[model samples]
Target: MFAAAAIAIIITMVLALIRGFIGPTLYDRILAVNMFGTQTVLVIAILGFMMGRPDFLDIALVYALINFVGVIALLKYFKYGSLSIGPGEERNTEKSSHMDKS
Candidate 1:
C-alpha cells in the first residue's frame, strides 16, 4: 500500500511540474510550484517510514517550512516587485497631494 501511495505522489508531482511549466498565468504557475513542494514533503515522509529512518521526517519538516516561506516571498515579489518592503509599507511610488489634505 505504501508503495502505491508513493507512486501516486510521484505521478502527481510530475503533473505539477507540467502545470508549473505551462500554466497560462503567473499565479497558476506559482500555485503549481507550491503544490509540488507540498507533495514533496508528503513523499519524503512516506519514504522515511518505508525505510525506517525517522531523520527524513525532520528534513521534510524543514523543507516544508522553506517551501512555505519561498511561496510567500514569490507572491510578495510578484505583487510589489520587491521583497524589501514591509507588509504595512505603501507600495505606490507617488502620494497624491489631494489625499494628504485629509
Candidate 2:
C-alpha cells in the first residue's frame, strides 16, 4: 500500500514537472513548481515511515514551511517586483514604479 502511494506520488510529480516546464505563463509555472514542492514534502514523509525513521518528518515539516514561504515570495515578487513590503506600502510601490520607468 505504501509502495502504491509512493508510485502515485511519483507519477504526480512527473506530471507536475512537465507542467512546470511547459506552462503557458509564469503563474502556471509557479503553481506547478509549488505543487511539486508539496508533493516532495509528502514523499519525504512517506519514505520516512517506510524506512522506520521518524526524523524525516521534521525535514518534511521544514520543507513545507519553506515551500509556503517561497511561493508567497514568488507571487509577491511577480506582483510588485520585490517582497520587501506589502502591496499597500507606498514607498516600496513608488520605488517599483521608478524602477519600471527606468
Candidate 3:
C-alpha cells in the first residue's frame, strides 16, 4: 500500500542522513544528501496520493528541480573555485591555475 511505501521512504531517508553525516569523504556525503533529497520527493508524492491532494505532485516536481540544481552547484563549487566563467581558453587556464594553487 501507499502507506507502506511511505514508511519505506522514511526509512531510506533516515539511512541517507546517517550516511551523509558519517561519510568518509565529501563526495560520499554529497551523494548521500542527493539520495536523501530524492527520497524526500518520493515521500511527498506518496503523501499527496494518500491525502488526495494533486498539489503535492507539483511541490515534488519543484523540489526535484531544486535538488538537481543544488547538487550541480555543489559539485561545481567543489571543482571550480567560482561559478563565473572566464571564457573558452581561460577555462582551461583557470583549471590549471586552480590545480597549481592546490
Candidate 4:
C-alpha cells in the first residue's frame, strides 16, 4: 500500500512539472510549481518509510519549508518587482513621481 502511494505521488509530481512548464498564465505556473513541491514532500516521506529510515522526514520538512518561502518570494518579486520586504524598506514613490515629471 505504501509503495503504491509513493508511485502515485511520483506520477503526480511529473504532471505538476509538466503543468509548471506549459501552463498558460503566470499564476497557473506558480500554482503548478507549488503543487510539485508538495508532491515532492509526500514522495520523500513515503520513500523514507519504505526504506526503514524515518529520518528522511526531517529532510522533507526542511524542503517543504524552503518550498513555501521560495514560492512566497517569487510571488512577491513578480508582483512588486522587488524582493525586499524588510520593515524599514520604503517605496520610492517620490522618485517615481519625479521621474514622471521629466
> For model 3, how does the per-residue alpha-carbon lDDT over 1-102 read when each residue is reduced to its tens digit?
998998898899889999999999999899998998899899889999999996899999899999999998888777665577433424546478678668
lDDT of all predictions, in order shown? 0.90, 0.90, 0.86, 0.86
Q: Over 4 Å off in model 3, which ranges? A: 86-102
Model 4 poorest 10 in a row by lDDT = 85-94
Q: Ten consecutive residues with minimal summed lDDT in candidate 1?
A: 92-101
Sorting all predicted structures by TM-score, with the top scorer first, yields 1, 2, 4, 3
Candidate 2 runs further than 4 Å off: 91-102
The sequence of per-residue lDDT tens digits that candidate 1 reaches over residues 16-99 is 999999999999899999999999999999999899997899999999999999999999999778898767566556576336
Separately for all candidates shown, the number of backbone clashes (residues 3 or more apart, or on different chains) is 0, 0, 0, 0
Cα TM-score per model: 0.84, 0.83, 0.80, 0.81
Candidate 3, RMSD to the unseen true structure? 4.9
Model 3, TM vs. native: 0.80
Query: What are the per-model C-alpha RMSD values against the true structure?
Result: 3.1, 4.3, 4.9, 3.9
Clashes of 1: 0
Candidate scoring better on lDDT of 2 and 3:
2
lDDT of 4 by residue, 15-50 (tens): 888988899999989999899889988888999999
Q: What is the lDDT of candidate 1?
A: 0.90
